[model samples]
Target: MRLTMLRGPLLVAPIALLTLIPLLVVLGSFLHPQPEVWAHLSEYVLPEVINNTLILMLGVGCGVLLLGVPLAWFTAVCEFPGRRFFSWALMLPLAMPAYVLAFVQVGLLDFTGPVQTLIRDIGGDSSWFPRIRSIGGVVLVLSLAFYPYVYLLARNAFLTQGKRALEAAQMLGLSRAQGFWQVALPMARPWLIGGLTLALMETLADFGTVAIFNFDTFTTAIYKSWFSLFNLPAASQLASLLVIFVLVLVGMEHWARGARHYHSRIVAAERIQLKRWHQIAVIALCSAVLLIAFVIPVIQLLVWAKSILQEDLDSRYLGFTLRSMMISILAASLVSLLALLLVFIARRFNSRATRWMVRLATLGYAVPGSVLAVGVFLPIAWLDNLLIPIAQSMGFATFQVLKGSVAVMLLALAARFMAVAFQPMDSTMQRISRNQEDAARSLGLNQRQLLWRLHLPMLRGGMLTALLMCFVDVMKEMPITLMTRPFGWDTLAVRVFEMTSEGMWANAALPSLMIVLTGLIPVVLLVIQSENKQD
Candidate 1:
């Protein structure tokens, strides 16, 4: 038994090391102070970057809460038209990347775009409209993109809490409004905060959206520090700061969620009957959000894609699509494999040390991709410097080996998405009966045989779900691929970034639409899963 426990942890050692490399590299940047870069950044860059990040987080925090909590409450508890459809339809926005939405909104709503042009042709004053290129616009775009995180969790929280909590409050002589504010809302606080945390993390990690809007967040700062300024240390230092901010957010969320569980009775609570006008209002709000966030953006993408289809559709795009799929498949497979191993080790060992190792391995998902890009790149670059000389001595003329290869990108992607794959597999693995495992062992089956025959067969559903989720995530990923891909290895995301950088909105649209379509697959599956659980 002792040897088995030791073996499980030993298997997890490499996974933990992989996760730690980026973190340790980023944190270690402080040791080598680039006095010139710090001097310039301290005066001009850090202030705006930190301020914008804080403001963005604050604005998005408020925006998602206002949008998500109400939508969750209405769909989960209130009786309204289209409630059943809206329950899943609202999650459709998850398929749209914030950057894609950012560019589409800017393309349509900017002063020179068709919307303002139409307004001008009709003799309306366009000067009164707020600029979509500003900080506020970025906040709005991100809020719309990420609110579904809160809605999903908060809706589940409300569904499980049900109207039982409200009835209890009413029994104590409180009205519906007061009951919701004082009892039901507070009961769902942990979930609400959890969802808010996820939205904020996405907001913080955002590079493409902020890049499109010309907003100076930590992510963009990190990117500029590396690519524009050609300062790796500066980039690593900025990434470290962002890592600090993410850690703070994670710590706060953990503290907020401490030892709290407010479970109401599981019986189905009757939906609240709303007045006639109220239903109309509810329907209007839900429709507006859906139209603005998902429907309108998709429609506009089709229009833009159509305009540039002839010029842009070629073997180039075929390459882009193939490269995106190839890398996504490779990265997803690697992440799923690591996640499965971690799940198995954690389950088999069931020790505190093993759990800690699993947690460390999965923590990479909390770190932003831009940060991971820097962290992964620096260590690999160092390794390349060491290996190139040895290779040259062996008569192998290689200037660089691992620095910009697909293998390095796979490593970074695997680190960034380990948790996305882990959560589903872990949940599925927990449902496997222990008695089956014991029976397999009692039949003199070795551990490898048992896992191959019993666990692998049972975990097929989870494995597919994990693989699909990670594949789509990698396909949509930008910073890691943008920073780490080999020469001429452009994915669809990189294509979008390149076109948007040149102010070619129409050219960006086809790739954006393709990405959105690919993204919808996993989301639809999630909706089905949620519906099954509800039933």
Candidate 2:
């Protein structure tokens, strides 16, 4: 009994630290926030922030569904020449970041841009094409990059839908359209909501994309409060408000999913078939989506990228690229490891509180990094302040723990990217049977032995998925790096944003391409894993 008691904590220590980091940051901020900050913020800030966030969330949510669901429906029911490519091609937008796509589109389509310049030279002016910087443009850009979130979920849901159910619908005198509406759509609503919720959260949390367009959402306000005004307390207040908005969205998502769990009536149902009209529809649908999502933005990037080569691609930025990749890879791998440990512990103990905490921690995925930095910086800075003075007072000479170290960056990565790492592992774990563990226990195996032998092998793919996802997130992440990076620590994302901030694309494209390429690794892997599961 003594040994078991001792071992439990020893086993549980990792989860404690994982949870403790964010908790410490949030609580610590409340204790020692920025001085004299309450007087500065306008009361109007809160309401405007909340309304803008909700508007963006709702707008992006609607736009993505409009684009994703039809494409998914067409591709599911229809056959086409590029049908095989359409199956996965629709998911490609996920590899591109919203801000990058947004800027690239503006660069190509903006007045005095190459397109407009050509138009003006040949008898055209400002009124020739609408500016791509308006709210509609923002909505268009977001929908393009984000519709993949909906596509994947809805497509998977459609693919797994049983043929028998649809056949029964036909037998009941329902037409194909009626069957899809009454039978298929209801079954797929859960999955569709799951995707829509993700896209909604993403839109609410986006800072860079909104800011570039001069949109004043809550995330932008938080960044202004923290970086421009240098008021950490007000930023926290704003962030706290932002968290409420996020939670409301999250709660609604949870309520929707809980209310709409779909059950299959028949076992091992047949796949639905597609025909020639479907082929034409699928082709047109895929082309339209890709036109908005991948082709237009990429063509714009290619244009700017060529101009960049005309500018410069020297040695100064090369080291930053290496540094960025090295740090992101390390942070991603570390967080993935931490997530596996936490998930393993959660599985063994079956703690509802622990599961809730894990779910809460993943809320970072939905939060803008600008806001998360406040959440991260508040507690650690307070802790660091207390420790640095004590360490100097005690006359130690080793190292400082928090303020200006890679530890802070890594901790931020763990806090932010944990969800990406945990999700795949959690899904994989659910698919596994407990018999292997029971059998191992009966055969004189320790828990560690059983896990190493049985669990690790089964979860290898999930582990890879988690690691790659985390790595890509780390690579593309910006807000935390901007706020919490140590004195001279800049990652690939930071460098890209910095160059783009100056309206310089030549220097940014290499790193931007790398970020997109890096993000694609996990996306491709997930697509393959999804295919394998289907097979």
Candidate 3:
């Protein structure tokens, strides 16, 4: 019994410590002073970073709510035209990363791009077009890319609320609109807030979209400080500020959702049906969103890929594809395994300390990849510096260790994505009956046997879901891979960044399309899962 009890903590502590280290390293920048850089940033750059970050967050928050909530409500509550198709179609945008969308939009809509050229050919001046590299453009692109988070959560919330609550509101002398405003909206508040929080976190952590737009934010600042200026301290400091911003947003989300129970009586009830014009309006709304968010962007990428296929399809491109898949598979497997172990331990132990440790381990997902890269790099570099001299003294000349290695990149990926794996595993575990374990134990099964025979088999679906999601996320990841990958270790994301940087949008399209295709696996799985739930 004692040995069994001790096992959980022993298994959990090391992973928890590993997860916390990067955050601690980033936060430790508060103690160190970067006088000259700090002074210059504080007076000029810091305010702009703060202002832009806030504006981006606010803009994305509003944009997501505007796009996500209404669509979620329509799909969940009303029987509109194309309701069946839009139910899954609305989620397609989740596969499109904000950065890829940014490039595609810019390539299509910029002053030098086809749209403006066509307008110019038709006699429109340059001033007739809105700039595609501004704050407004960033917000639109990010919103289109990220609103699915809000839509998914809000749709689930509305579905879970069922028809009874809305009926009750209608019986209370309230109109459908009034019921939605007073009851449905309030009940969905927690979910809406949760979704908004996720969108804002992604926005805050964004490096590629903002960088492509040349819009300065905390994430951009962190990247520039470390890579451009070669100032680790300044980068760390900027990362610290970004972390604080994330924490504050998380805290605000918690406070906004405080002590609120949004549960409705679960009953099988008929959904609200819309009339002809209302149905048409709902269909049009959903179609417009889908077209703008997923269809157009994907079509543009396909066209670009078609244009460059013969020239870009070669050994080097294949190498990049293989490298990306290899790293993503490896990282996804590691993160999913770790998440399973952490969750299993937490369930078996069921202690406050163990639970909190698990929670802390999962918090890495909230930290931006850029910040995590900086946090991870500093310690690994220091360790390499310490070990290199010792190796030299032992007659091993020119031996280098951790810095600029694939291991560091994998570690950073694991830290950034473990939460993605954990959430699904945790939710699945909650649905599992504890009696199964007790039954196994009565049959003389030990913990290991019980897990292998019972839990592992039952957890197959969840584990795969977690693994695929992590794989896709790692494939789309930019900042961590950019900062930590070894020499000549360029992933597809790096290829996209490089080509886009050099204004090679056609070349960037192939890899960008590959990423989107890879990402589609999880999004398709998500749609299937949601449909299964509905069924």
Candidate 4:
């Protein structure tokens, strides 16, 4: 308690710049929404937006549960020949953005696509296959990419519970099916729901995927209203609705998890062996998911690239992409540093209020990126108005650079990605023993010295994980950047969205490819680390 109280400034100082501003934006939005926008929302726009959002949420919720649990089961309990490889391979889809997958799916299944061509060759009408540019395709793409969230959580939960209880159920009158349904599934429910919530959030926050498909979801609606129609108030109103939906879903998850009463036993359970048929079934299931979600779409993207083989890329767009990357890198670093502070403070205090602070910080994760954009922008712009004048009076003329510059881009990225930074730090802090801090204190180390000498060393890997995730997150970001970016600023995601919207697939495809490629790096590192630890 002493250490925690004394260390507040060190833990809280870095985040004060971030935490104070975003809330000001959200508050301003609520208090000052235009009357005309409120009328539009109350009459028709809000209902359609809310319905479409819920529909997408329901679709992803069901799809992820179907894929995530079974795939996790295959790896955790039942073994297939390539189960080892597939266990990690399934995570590859996670590296692909929904918008990228949207383009790939459309190219492969639209009227002029290869599949339709092959069908026409077989004396079949291409109309036999539904167009991929619809709600169904959006759901399909989102579920495939997002199910890995469920798989990761569910698989770990299963391994943690182990098989001891599973065997005892077998020794009783219960069959394997009964035991799994009644025993194992309940134990994994918390993890499954947690994964489901993540998938739902991704689906809800998605803009590129739904927009490319011509869907009317909240994310797309906001992009259209704000950027295309120049209706800022309308967009804010829509974004607020999206935020409410997300809060409800998150609340339900919290309620359900809090309601759960099961306890996981500490002793390791004997691992279950898969029957021959079960092994084959497992392999087939994983293969089918990968084919639809990853393999087919990737093949289609490559095929499309073949036609653009000789085209010279525009120098301007290339520069745009490079500019985006640099900003993303810097913003990722800043977000991670501030998040490190928040996580350390939360863990150090480890009290009800501190825990709530940590949760509120992560609340940015559930709010649509567009909502977070609103939350971050208003106060920051106001702050700049104050700071720039003071600096100019002090004979510093260029301090005006922050008003609508790359610095704003970096701060927006930090507000959006604070959650990503908090997650790994939270997990790592949980594993730290209190005795280490006690031992350091007994050795006459001050709080700062103990943190630097003891806690920070043990947390390097987790901090790196947080930093890398933030880097990739900002790299693929679109919604918040679209809303908050300074004039003339462009990101790879923005470039991809722009090109795809204009039917310039050839250029869009490259940047989409770049986005996925960048997202893959941190994921690859994390996977290798996971594999190494398992070894």
Worst 10 residues of 2 by lDDT: 264-273
TM-score of candidate 1 against the unseen true structure: 0.97
- Expressed as tens digits, the lDDT of each residue in 1-535 for candidate 2 is 5554345345656555554556445555546645455444455576666666666776788899998888776555444577667777788889998878877777777775777888888885657488787878888888888898898888777776756657889999998789989988888988899899889878877776887677788778888887888877777877766666766887887887785447643235545566777656667778888876777766666666677765566675676787787877888888788778867877876655556556655656766666667766777777877787678778876445877677777777777777888889888888777876788889998988978887898899888888878878877777777778887677677777777777776567767777887778877885786566453
Once model 1 is optimally superposed onto the true structure by TM-score, how far is the C-alpha of residue 44 displaced, in angstroms?
A: 1.9
TM-score of every model? 0.97, 0.89, 0.96, 0.90
lDDT values of the candidates? 0.91, 0.74, 0.88, 0.76
User: TM-score of predicted model 2?
Assistant: 0.89
TM-score of the candidate numbered 4? 0.90
The per-residue C-alpha lDDT of model 1 at residue 470 equals: 97
Best by lDDT: 1
In model 2, how many backbone clashes occur? 4
- Candidate 3, 46-124: lDDT as tens digits: 9999999989988999999999999998888777667889999999988888899999999988988988999888886
Selected candidate, larger TM-score, 1 vs 2: 1
Q: Is candidate 2 or candidate 4 better by TM-score?
A: 4
409-522: candidate 1 lDDT, tens digit per residue? 988898999999999999999999899899999999898999899999989999999999999999999999999999999999999999998889999999999999999989
**lDDT by residue for model 4 (1-535), tens:** 6666546554554465464456545555767778888887768676777777778889989999999998887777664588778878888887888888887777777888778999999987777687677778878888887998998888877776667657768899788889889888988889888999999988888888888888788887777777778886677666666766777888899898985576653344556778888778778888998888777767666666666755835676677777777877788788888788887787667666556556666666776787777656556667778888889889997575565666666766776678888888778877888887888899999989988998899889889889888888888888877777778678788888888888666667767777787888777876785565331
TM-score of candidate 3 relative to the true fold: 0.96
**Model 2 error, position 522 (Å):** 1.1
True-vs-predicted CA distance for residue 514, candidate 2, Å: 1.0
Q: What overall lDDT, based on C-alpha atoms, would model 1 receive against the true structure?
A: 0.91
